[model samples]
Target chain A: MRKTLTTIIALALVAGGVAACGNSDSGGDGKIVLGFSQVGAESGWRTANTKSIQDSAKEAGITLKFSDAQQKQENQIKAIRTFIQQKVDVIAFSPVVESGWDTVLKEAKAKKIPVILTDRAIDSKDTSLYKTFLGSDFVEEGRRSAQWLVKATEGSTDPVTIVELQGTTGSAPAIDRKEGFAEVIKADPKFQIIASQTGDFTRAKGKEVMQAFLKAHKDIDVLYAHNDDMALGAIQAIEEAGLKPGTDIKIISVDGVKDAFVAMTEGKINVVVECNPLLGPQLMDIVKKVVDGQETPQRIVTEEGVFTADQAAAALPNRKY
Target chain B: MITWTRHRLFWPVMLLVLLLLSNLFFTPDFFSIQMKQGHLYGSLIDILHFGAPLILVSLGMTLVIATGGIDLSVGAVVSISGALACWTISQQSDQGSLGVVVMAVALSLGVTALLGAWNGLLVAGAGIQPIIATLILMVAGRGVAQLITDGQIITVNSSPYKVIGGGYLATLPFSILLVAIVVAATALLTRRTALGLLLESVGGNAEASRLVGIRSRGLIAMTYIVAGLCAGVAGLMISSNVSSADGNNAGLWIELDAILAVVIGGTSLLGGRFSLTGTVIGALIIQTLSTTIYTIGVPPETTLVVKAIVVMIVCLAQSPSFRAKVFRRPGFAPPAARPGEPGPDAAPAGPADPTETKAEVPA
Candidate 1:
């Protein structure tokens, strides 16, 4: 039938297009074809992270086939399937929110295209599904934030009434950071979280929710934002209320973005726990290691640190994390 | 009593009052206001600044709603335009060049317009539902934005952009002025032209409008194009404000807020009628409620629940069916009715005849 012939031709074209992407020099002292699926630009840090990978790929002589999933898991799955069809040598992606990736990872494993998670980690029971996760330890980042608070309010008579501006609910960072911070904060009876809610990791919602927190709570001694954006938003609300932000109420946040350091230098924010986003060098190192048939760990933990106002100011000119 | 209560705005107003009263009881200095730098500074101004984008997008949404079409892609359009503007500016020889800023704005608008037309073509020419058609772009546009930025925040040291996003014009924000212009222009466009009439006709009855030679499809597509333009403008403002082209986070979840604003303004999501003034007021109310909650020190965890309740109340109040039912109950009087004496009986004023009014038309 004409319809069947047309269908066959259409199928052939698709197959040919995919096949064409695979004719690069083989991995024997030549370029390695890498299919990099990125969680679409949703934040400043994500944008920076993506650029790192792309630039690194160019420098490392890898033929990169990039796909942006636009912050959806389904799209990521489809992109991965396409990558498999293309038969790229290695697969790298930043999973958006960190679940529903097991089957896709298994498929990548079956294809022998090693998977590397950038920025966020997955919750898969099968550890072998991914070769390694190249990102900051989210738990440690949270603990650093709580530890700063514990030290700051050690001898204060006023029971430290803290409010938390959480990141996206059910996200890897949100889940792990909450667990890690609570692990430390639960030990002290005086320190209480009067209000803790998701700002959805957005500036607008952070400001909105912080406004409500300010209205309802009479005495919030400290604000612990899951990310710098929320903390910055809370700062706006704090200043609007004719109250000093870092001085009147001690503020601590995670994600040592350049803006966070700027806030710290201005004395608007108290401290920031760094979650390094510039993973270009590490990602390149891992990609080369994988392609060279060299053994690498299943998790490559990036070092994280906490910085106060003085440290933030001192390090502002040179801090890349 | 029953006849008098059949108004939509009654419920939303009541809900607003209830929210305010609750805040008064719970919050300290919930109504506090201060003067700073020759302008009002408080939770109120903060709400306005934050809510301006929602209001602008909602105004755009009002027209699309009037045509029985929804724009799920506005958020993505915003991201793309924001990224485009930032990337374009970053490519300048001089970082803060005005030529680059103007070119960036123009390029961003052109691209967004093209994308908007793509949606319009699918919905109008291909006869796809607006929701499904726009949803495709919603999923892909952000990816395109990321591609434009090479998945990195394209930082620009542009003065014009800083002014647009973070710079103040005398005492007010430049972003606020931009929003005002968009709102004013849209209001005049709809109110001062026959375009509004045509849109309502198409939304109210597409077949009837077609029979009357209105070219309904063209009108529908035009509304989308305009909405896209508005979103592009919003994108420029957002990126300029942040001084970075972060496509990922530039305008995430903005579409939802715009939808909420449209709904709160009593615009029927099913389409046919819209109110630009009401949309602005609605955005203000939502922003104020949010500010009040934060100022009053509501637990941040409870804020979502509170917002949900507020949305529900506003929606219920605006529903004619809900209003009619509430008014028919005892002890209920119409908002406009006198307090002491019942102005009218709970029955039809005259012998009722079944007549086909525009209000009775099924969507």
Candidate 2:
């Protein structure tokens, strides 16, 4: 049994070595080999983000080595180490969390391989570690949502009671979005947020919370969700309550996913502030630039647009996510 | 009065009532039900409607825990079943067809039953610990669910399928009716037959149960299958409610809630003397607490802390020893120690030890 165990271990090591050698050889043809790590398909927004990265990599003719970390930081660290070993030309990953990337990132820097952060930013103080951070500004998304709400409810002297359906509490998007909306809405004395609760960025919780909000506050005039899924859920609750969602309770949300566009066309959601997840094309451009020893900005924000019901109809047919 | 208070379900019912009453403090119309477009609409109905899934899952969990086993994979089963049903429905040419929806539901439940059978085999045949056996599926099942949906949320526009969760039946949410039928069927299957007694005996003492010629292995396996089926139904309700299936978020952490419900329902984790009514009340209490948090205007950051405190209070209130200790002042009579009753301290192995009778069945 001992001899067989030793033999099995030896064979496994040999197999792993062969696999590692094969990975290294794939980049030997002078093509730009890019290793990208993703933070798993936790939501529709994330799925779209991943598809964008994969498709854009193909378009750029970059040899992509992709790894899904499944929302675990340790898995991401392991993938980065493997990328370092494979000696890819560029490394990019959407960090699962903002912290704890300093160690793995320093290792990449030691090998002189530039790392780019996508869809999310890291909290590391060292700016020299990564080439650039490419993603949407969640706070700006929130500001745009508030801007649309302000315009829609303009000239109304009556107090517009808003019920805010936040994302997961303490998350970056939740905190920043709340801050930006509160900042923008602070200018209008007629706007009052009577109830604010976390929907955990999920459809079920959003619906459940919205039901409770409707019960607690009978005169809610507007609903702001941190994400589109929650808005969709709240729309159901609004409909069940015999209230017209977009007409009776103006609904504004972020994440211009396909479902949100459908709801917009249905006139359930009033507007959607797009937190664009399609950072793939821009990410590949930055990766090529970094590989060619060109200077890149430390931060690159993707351009997004706010859509209303009318725009949703024209955009519905071509909606990808 | 003494007999009523002594009942196992008494504390859970009282706690649920207290939770519902607390909501009245925030919203005066908490108990008022209104009719809207031929359907009942109110906080109470919402609690029942939303709490149905937890009640169903906990009912099955009560049986499994009664059989001396835990099924951590119920959450995973929920996601897998929902993912399968939605995927199947999405594949149909006519997604709104009742026949197609029924086929999808049947197929999903059938697959869930097979997964349950696999867990049962691992526990009974392979002699693996129940927690370990189910944990395998609990981790892998999400991946299977994600694979079914191709790591994307599958949304369907099936009106017939939506009736299971979001529709109304005779002015009540269909989900509530579904829960009532499942609870009634489970109660009848366990109490109106020898199954309940046999399960309690096996859980009370596995060795003694085997000596009594009881098929403990098959019984344990059947409990897991029932748990899987309960989770399957819950998955359908959840997906149908939203008209979409999210593999990652569907029924997430629901097994933990079900286990908490089972425990709060006065069912011991050591597995004997289960209470279906208590589980139902416990689920309602949880749902009410969630509603109360929002109604009472608890801050978003402090919601979890508030929930933990409420759950802790309910758990402490259910414990006889804790109640006795708290009401031990000189002027106050401990609730557990009434005037005509021997105190719980006096009778160390009194009515509380129902497992004692089952342990002697082999003799």
Candidate 3:
């Protein structure tokens, strides 16, 4: 493990070192240099988020000094410190974990470098530490998924036994999604979550847990998965159990990735709640506006699309992720 | 009379049986298998199927621990091998091609064997502490796996590859068959030949084995390579089952389970006197517990706690001191004095224990 730890640390150092060399104190062309700290490429969504930011910065002609934190809070802190040391015009980052950022954000604030929060939110109530926050409201994502379910299962007077394949337990998405789903379904007496368990946001655990759910409950009407990966896994388990996924058991999931769309088109998945990851253009716009001395909104919610099976066939070919 | 009770497998087998019996209360047909489309389906069958990967890894771990070494890198090797094989297959124009799948598996195993040798070299040749030595690969291996996978879950569509994990041959899960073949071959190589005895000797005393002209270095390295090969196969099964190689999540924390299986299988982490059957049973016990967690409706938060309690009971059952302390109370006889000092109850499973296994301590 020392080998990998050394490798990640060295990689971070080299990245920061090379960028630091490009400009000793000021960036080229006398343009605004936006220092961006990303939360590493841990998922397809994060990868897309990184790409969008990079592409948008280039298109906008801003000097983007980027640092990948490799999903560690310490690395993010280090990158933020480096940004402060370099005296970039504007500093922005997606905090890996919510807490432990007050001290660092305070430093950036004291230095008069405006910070922008992207993709995720931090727990600190002090909004003045950052100029603006732009991302999807995770609780809203959950509420949207459940609302779609309610509309789809409209007029269903019979009891709907929904087996929930939750994401990693206690994560923001998992907790918010559960709350949102419950908030919508609670009013309706027909829908009841008879069994729910964490799949840990992985396909293998999703399938294993779903298979057990299938065996334990024979009257499952819906499989509400916390993410697309788990829904896809549950589809396989349902198929292997000699049941049609979309027909016999409807699957509604979050994350409108291409795979989920393909599943939706195949009628294996019923609907998908989209979590917009393409925040680069918007983030770049916000950064440029913030730097232009314009008062931006404290929180900017990105517009997202909800896809049904009817829309999946038309959308699959152009799916960017 | 206590000879039977002193047998290495007495505690593990007893724990396994007790667990199985306890399941009968919740699942009436827990042990009964029904034919679903000419294939077995039941809690017992699921145990063997899902237990295949752990069985393979633990079988290798038993040998490594038998030589007084622990391979913490097995889980990482699993993720790496799975990532490599899946990546190679996904790159192929025809992922379903049998020839390409074979090459992918071979290449994956080849790389894993080298990783094993790296651990072995650090421990046996460089004379580093076994835990610290293997820890290097343990930490770095998964990162390398994620690197190979390019930080994305690589899903493949190959029937032959899927067969390794989910396919059935003659109404039995192919994975179970794979485990059986590997277990039988491993048991034969260790018990029928003198290799097992040689390993036991090296693990029992590295200094004494060296003084007796034994090549301890070669044997130690060989065990690690074997462990790597086993981990590679297990990796294939995991990725194949899901048709996806999730570098971050695949085989996460599996090394701990493998080590626990080895310990529970009557093999000391200090090394020597291993049992393949016992390891198989131990792996099944772990898998059954997981299945029980789901079937018996134990919350996910409390799942690990329940496992910890079960492990404690199993360890206590195996401990002669603990057993003696409890049994010595209330007019009951304690387990036979020690490994060599056998009594009649221990005689059932140890027809040749006194002769071949001198320092064998299941506890």
Candidate 4:
């Protein structure tokens, strides 16, 4: 193990040394060089978010120095510091997690590079660290999901048992979505959560947690999944148990992904609250506005909505984000 | 009699029982069972289904561990092989040819095997640490997988491909059958062949094995090859189940789960003794624990804390000190102690007990 560690370190150093060779042509004519550190491709949403940022940068003719942090905070910090060293015009990143980033953002701020957050938000109390945050209103999404569920089961006396599939623990979305949903559902004392688990925003975990919930709870009316992947996973578990998913246990999840819409249209999923990931155009607009000395809001929320099965069928053909 | 109690599986079994008992009390309807499509469908079944993949990986992991090595790249290999299979099936030119499909399968397995060999050579031949050797592939293999699919999700429309991962045999998932086959094959190979003995000898003392003319390098390389093959099979199961080849998400964090399964199943990461059955059971236990957490209405975020606590408890239970304390308690007798034998606490202070000393020695 020790030998492997040394070799890995040596290789990493060599790789890092070689990487420094590619930055000499950073457009010497004072171009707007933006360092965009992306979260790793952990999901379809993340992959799409990355493409949006890259495409927007290309379209805007910005010098985007991009790095894929591969979901590691340390890798992201290293990339950000490298960007600072290179003296980019602006720095931006969609952090994998919210904490452990104040120090890196501070460095970028000290270097005079305004940082913009995309997709996910940071947990820092000091809002001045990043220039602006542009993303979906996750809390609103949760509320919308809950509101739809309330409407779906308006007069049904069958007790509504919620089995929530949360995202990664401590993540901004997971924290906010749970809070927001709880706020909306707290009004009804009958609405009880029988099982809640962090599916870690992955399909496999979602299925695993849901299976456990099935064992622990004899009756389940609703599954509120934080993301489409988990909901889809829950759908599989639901079906595997010989119970009709949509009829037996209604699923209302966030992330208006294409698959979510498909599930809804097929009547397997009851509702989907859209969390627009194609903030590419909006993000680029904000970046241009911020760089051009125009005042911007601290929070820029993308337009979002809820889709039922009927709406899902109507929107499936045209829904892009 | 004490030797039987000190057997490695004893601790893991105790943990399984403790978890089951805890779930029985703390969780509502914990023992509830359901029948779906004429087969048992409940939390237990769900655990088996969910853990089947990890069990397969850990089965391979056991061999790698027994060879005094680790394969951090198994997860990456799974991703690559899954991506490769999806990419091949998605190829429009030879869409329906069985021969072409077979060739693609062979090629994907070949690539993974080559990667395993590379890791094996680095560790066994170049003397690189197994972790570091496999870590290289772990990081770089994802890039290669992504490159293969051009960072696109390659959706497979092939029936055979889907059947390989998502189909059922006699009401059981084909993936589970695949796992069963792999587990049974591995057991047979190890217990019924010289390979197991050679692996144990090599892991116990590589220098001694070399002195005795055992080709430890070849055995090490074969272990990796076997692991790569298992990963290839796992990749097929995952990709087909999803009907898509997602290079980024496929098999992500699987290595951690595989390692956790191996550890939980009573396999020492440092290598030597291994049990495929124990590993499978460990995988089931992990899945069941997660299932239990979700079943009882525990908040998902709390699962992290729950998993951490459970793992810590299991580790503590394995400690000799903890066992000794437990046995010393009133109404609790050491299972192996004779009627007149001194209780653990009553033993005179002397040279450290060989069993305790050996337990303290890090594998």
Candidate 2: tens digits of C-alpha lDDT, residues A46-151: 8999899899999999989999887778999999999998899999998776778788899999999999988777887898999888888888988998999889
Tens digits of per-residue lDDT for model 4, A1-321:
677679779999998888777787676976677888987765667767778888988898788899988777899999999999998877888888879888988988888888999878999998999889989888888888889887877887666888788888877888889888999999887799866778877776676677667766768888999998888878877887778988999888888877778889899998888888787778777777878888889988888787888888889998663
Top candidate on lDDT is 2
List of chain B TM-scores, one per candidate = 0.84, 0.93, 0.92, 0.84
Candidate 3 per-residue C-alpha lDDT over B1-363 given as tens digits, one digit per residue, 9 for 90 to 100: 445666667888888888878877776767777787778776777778888999999999999999999989999999999999999999999999999999999999999999999988988987878898888888899889988998788889999999998888999999999999998888778877778889989998988998999989999999999999999999999999889898877888899999888777767777866777778888888887787777777866677889899988887787655665676676655445457765554542343242545454321
TM-score: model 1, chain A:
0.89
Could you give candidate 2's per-residue lDDT for residues B239-305 as a string of tens digits? 9998889898888889999999988887889986787877888888888898899888899999999
Decide which is better by lDDT, 2 or 3: 2
Candidate 2 chain B, which ten residues in sequence have the lowest lDDT sum? B354-363
Tens-digit per-residue lDDT, B1-363, candidate 4: 655566556777877777777776766556666567866665555566666767777777888998779899988899899889888878857566676667677888898888888888888888878998899899899999988977766665676666677667777777888788778777777777777778878888888898999998888888888888888888877776766777877788788878887877766676766667668767777766766666655665466788888877876666556666776787865454557656663552211243342342122
Among the numbered candidates, top DockQ falls to: 2
Worst 10 residues of 1 chain A by lDDT: A21-30
Error of model 3, residue B291, in angstroms: 2.1
- Candidate 3 lDDT over A1-321, as tens digits, reads 587578769999998899767767466568889999987654556667788898999999888988877667899999999889889989989887677889999999899999999977887878788999999887787888889878887887888889998876545567778888899889999899888888877788888888777766678889999889889888988887778999899889988877789889999999999988899999888988988899999999989888999999998998888
Model 4 CA lDDT for position A286: 75
Judged by DockQ cut-offs, the docking class of candidate 3 is: acceptable
The residue-level lDDT of candidate 2 at B56 comes to 89
Give the CA lDDT, 0 to 100, for residue A78 in model 3. Answer: 97
